[model samples]
Target: MKFIISVDCEGPACVVGNAGKALSASRDYNFACREATLEANAAARALFDSGAREVWIWDSHGQGLNLCIDQLDKRCKLILGKGFTCRFPGLDNSFSGVVMIGYHAMEGTKNAILAHTYSSESYKNIRVNGQTVGEIALDGAVAGEFDVPVIFVSSDDKGCREALTFMPWLETVVTKQGMGRNCALSKHPHMVQEEIYSGVLKAVNCIHQTKPLKFKSPVQLEIDFKAVSQAVKALVYRRRGWRLVGPRTITKKIESMREWIC
Candidate 1:
């Protein structure tokens, strides 16, 4: 089997804050990235041990360059950088399953560490068919388009719960319990990696039972920006199906998840 591990910087036990801090070149930022690298590599190693033919790691954090590439599992291929034309770039029907590591909750999730949907500075919320969703749901839907199920996920308590709502059969590891957006009671990095390794092994064993996360046809996609200026700037998308539903909100109706996301 083949697998892809979509890794985000926040919600991992080793990271207390969001990837936005990495932009400032902080020491803690590098440390968090290194720890997340170890966790991701752990998952990759587990997949390889579980008879995986291939494993790809996507640095799905800010700027898509946060992971410590030198430390990643040597057998795994890395997908880095940004400016992709679509969501989950390079992902296709060829892959078997997706593993989300260090994911977070949506913008308004209570007691969720570093919580935001896509962007902390811009988006207020993102909804699919009137239901608010975070990266967990959005990414899962994108993988679903390829018939790939998100088999495993590791995050803070709220984040793991959020993943469960979308994929109840999923194997999850909670790295922390969120006290607030920037505060969490986290497990040790070693413990988090151990759980991630074991969780991936279990997920692989039950891959046949898990189902891809799919939404009904004709999806309604909505974006609520944090500022009116952001919405004004996004008005250019109006020609591409976006409509100004409010001063800081845009809505679009599409025939499939692929239309809005792919």
Candidate 2:
């Protein structure tokens, strides 16, 4: 068996700052990335224990290059670069399962750790048919396109809740409970790692029982931005329910996955 692990920063044990916008390396963004990688490694170890012969990790954080590779489990291969159309790269229909690590809340989440969907400069919130979704959901939809299943996800309380809404049976490890988007009560890194290991093992062992992660066809995606000009750019796709949110943002909602464009 083979598994693909997608790792993101900002929702691990103690993440709190925006990507790159963090004031210093000591900021939550950087700290979160390292912690996120540890979680990924734990999951990879569990995958191996569950009969997975190979586990590939996709570094899906800011700039698509956040995971610390050398410290990762030697049993896995890490994909760290910004070369894919989607953040999750080199993933195809062949993998037995997919796991998301250190994912945060969707854009506009209230009191959720480091919340932002795609780009903060790009959007204030992103909704699909009026429902909020995070990076995990969009990436999972891409995986669903190929008939792959998202078996596990790791993040804070909000992120885990988001995943459960889409894929109820998938396993999750919540490392933090946010007091706000930038403030959260987190477990120690060691405890977080323990949960990651156990969660991944359970996910892989029960992969068959875990349902696939999918969205309704003709998916309606609303992209709300922080600027009006950005919303104007979406005018071209108006036929798909794209609209401007006053003079400061854009919103689009489609019901079918006629095409995946981002």
The number of clashing residue pairs in model 2 is 12
The residue-by-residue lDDT of candidate 2 on 164-259, one tens digit each, is 888888899889998886678889899999989998888878888866566776676677767777777767645555666677556555553424
Question: What's the distance in Å from true for residue 17, model 1?
Answer: 2.4
Please estimate how well model 1 matches the true structure, expressed as its whole-model Cα lDDT: 0.86
Worst 10 residues of 2 by lDDT: 18-27
RMSD of each: 1.9, 3.1
**Alpha-carbon lDDT, every model:** 0.86, 0.77
Model 1: ten consecutive residues of lowest lDDT: 18-27
Q: Model 1: runs farther than 4 Å from truth?
A: 18-27
Model 2 residue 58 CA deviation in Å: 0.6
What is the alpha-carbon lDDT of model 2 when measured against the actual structure? 0.77
Candidate 1 Cα RMSD after full superposition onto the native fold (Å): 1.9
